[model samples]
Target: MKNCIIIGVAGGSGSGKTTVAKNLVKAFKSEDAVLVAQDAYYKELKEMSVQERAGVNFDHPNSIEFELLKKDLETLLKNQIIERPIYDFKTHSRKEETITIHPSKIIIVEGILLFAVPEIRDIFDVKIFVDTDADEMLLRRIERDIHERGRTFESVRDQYLKTVKPMYLEFCEPSKRYADIIIPRGGENKIAVNMVIAKLKRYLQKGAL
Candidate 1:
């Protein structure tokens, strides 16, 4: 790729950023687009006990290794492959094995904190934010945690009240001002998704010419 474009997608947890990112990737050829998640670079909690790790505030920016994410993005942008870390949600730590991501023409990086952190945020060529209602976000989060993270309703609710909502208000919501595009109603908004895909295709076409 002569000109690789890095697109950053940000939104609160359960706000449909992941869905939007996935749909965006699906709109293009697999080789031309790839989606990377910021959660993959979560800070290693090996020193803490599993129980203790469960109590860690994952929604906070401190809990993520943005420097590593930045480095990996740089590597991919340089037309190099990266050994992307595999995070074990059950263990709340990184697994030994890493996934390999080859260079691609379009990179979509989705995370809650990307827009909140200047070091990582400033690197993106295009920034997107997905806006979803708080009630809807909480509901989606509850369902996701129960199914994916092996959490109970009580624990998920407690964590949402303790960290997720508060952190999102402080960090994620405020960062929306930085976004070049804001997709409301998330991936369910087909028109919004189509528009974004169209814009990206146009950009790539311009680069090819």
Candidate 2:
């Protein structure tokens, strides 16, 4: 972790930020890099009823446990392993166990509200914003939530209208100004991704010098 580079990938839900982060990881050897998803840091809702948890505004910055997320990243930066939380999207709570993440030279943090929270955002060495059309975002969200996240179409659509779109306007969208790089055309923009990969390699190379 001696010259570790922390990259923040931020965007609206389903904006392809996770895809871009995965692309960055693909550019490096596994031992040299790791991906930390902000989705895993959602505040534990053990106290809430299932119905109440379902009503929670997941798109808001307050829904995430940013202090713990920052601390975990700081732990990794110190060349230590961390017991990363494992969240269950279906259950809307964290699992009893955690996964261990070893230190890496490159850390890619991907999430919708990543840049909106100052405590977490301030720690990033590079801030990347993935830009996509709102309509496309909604489409992708609907697809992913229903298939991958075990959410119903009605639930996904309702959440988007209730929290996702509004929260993006109030928090996530405005955060684009803090980005050092804005990647257009979503994650399929290989040229933009490659440019970033090249710069990241240079950063690691320079650290060796």
Candidate 3:
């Protein structure tokens, strides 16, 4: 069998990086493709109080369990299955159990800060950055966090205004230079998506699927 291909999709919060990654996974049509999200690696927060959790700057790179994540991905790349951590957004904690992931023909790792760390960045065959307007992203983040993450609108706005927005500018946006493709306007740009799909198809057929 051909070796699996690892693709990294990264962008600012609510910038549609996951949307694009999902579409790419579906386009592959092979059951051998797996989707892994960076959100799943949020540091275990069991002992921290609500006040302590609220004080966390989640947008920071240190907020993720990078060591564990890197080890898990390495196992997956070696054709071995691994238990992936499951993070609870509402509770701000890690679940007792993890989800199992089997070896796949393709791996799509999506995150807001995928390229921020050099260790994780080196493993990807393809790196994508979803570029979207700040105003639009903030609006989408507010709606998603309030509705899906069980967060108050005021808190969501506060977090975005304070940590999220600043981190995107200082950490996420600057990492765009490392991407193989810079997708403007995120998933709304079909041209960029189609191009990525085409390139991936070619790679898949070239004994690297």
Candidate 4:
């Protein structure tokens, strides 16, 4: 089996990182290419009330269970299957059922802080940073959180002001230095994604697909 090509996409919230990763997956010839979001590994908040959990600084790098994510990737790299956690954003808890992840030739890990943790960074063969303007990011985040993630406008603003912005500056932005590629404008920039596809294709030919 070819070695699993782990690609990490890190960026500010609503920077269109996931969109780019998904498009890149579509560009791949093999159906084994899969994109996994870091949001899926948010630490289970079963003990806390929904309101209290909402107050949690989810934007913090510490909020994710990176160890388990790393282990899942490690297993996948060895051609093994693993169960991924299912998180409920509305209730702020984890569901009993898990999403089964089978081995893939390419794994795209898109998240806010994938490169913030040294251990996780080392696991990725390629690291990408999606760059976008802060104001636009906030606007997109507000819309998405309210309509898709069951978040209130006030709460979203509060979190962005208190945690998201600061955490992004302190953690996410700084981690850009670790990226092998920095993509501006995220998904809309087909050139960047095409470059990524080309590299992956070359790597695959070199027996490291």
- Among the numbered candidates, top TM-score falls to 1
Where does candidate 2 stray beyond 4 Å?
Answer: none
lDDT of 3 by residue, 1-209 (tens): 54888999999998999899999988877576889999999998768997788879999999999898899899998999899989988878888999998888889999998999999999998899999998999989988988898999889988988899999999999999999989988889989999988887887788653
Candidate that scores best on lDDT: 1
What tens digits encode model 1's per-residue C-alpha lDDT throughout 1-209? 35789999999999899999999999899899999999999999878999999999999999999999999999998999999999998889999999999989999999999999999999998999999999999999999999998999999999999999999999999999999999998989889999989988997788742
Of candidates 4 and 3, the better by lDDT: 3
Per-residue alpha-carbon lDDT of model 2 for 68-152, expressed as tens digits?
9999999999999999999999888999999999999999999988888888889998999999999999999999999998999
Query: What do the candidate models score in CA lDDT, each in turn?
Result: 0.93, 0.92, 0.90, 0.89
Instruction: List, residue by residue over 24-134, the lDDT tens digit for candidate 4.
Output: 888876565887889889998878888899889988978999989999999988988889998888887789999987888889899999999999999998899999989
For model 1, what is the alpha-carbon lDDT of residue 76? 96
Instruction: Give the least accurate 10-residue stretch of model 4, judged by summed lDDT.
Output: 27-36
Given candidate 2, what's the lDDT at residue 28?
97
Distance from true location, Cα of 5 in model 3, Å: 0.9
> TM-scores of the models, in the given order?
0.97, 0.97, 0.95, 0.95
If ranked by TM-score, best first, what sequence of candidates would result?
Answer: 1, 2, 3, 4
C-alpha lDDT of residue 90 in model 3: 83
- The TM-score of predicted model 4 comes to 0.95
Query: Which residue pairs does candidate 1 place in steric collision?
Result: none
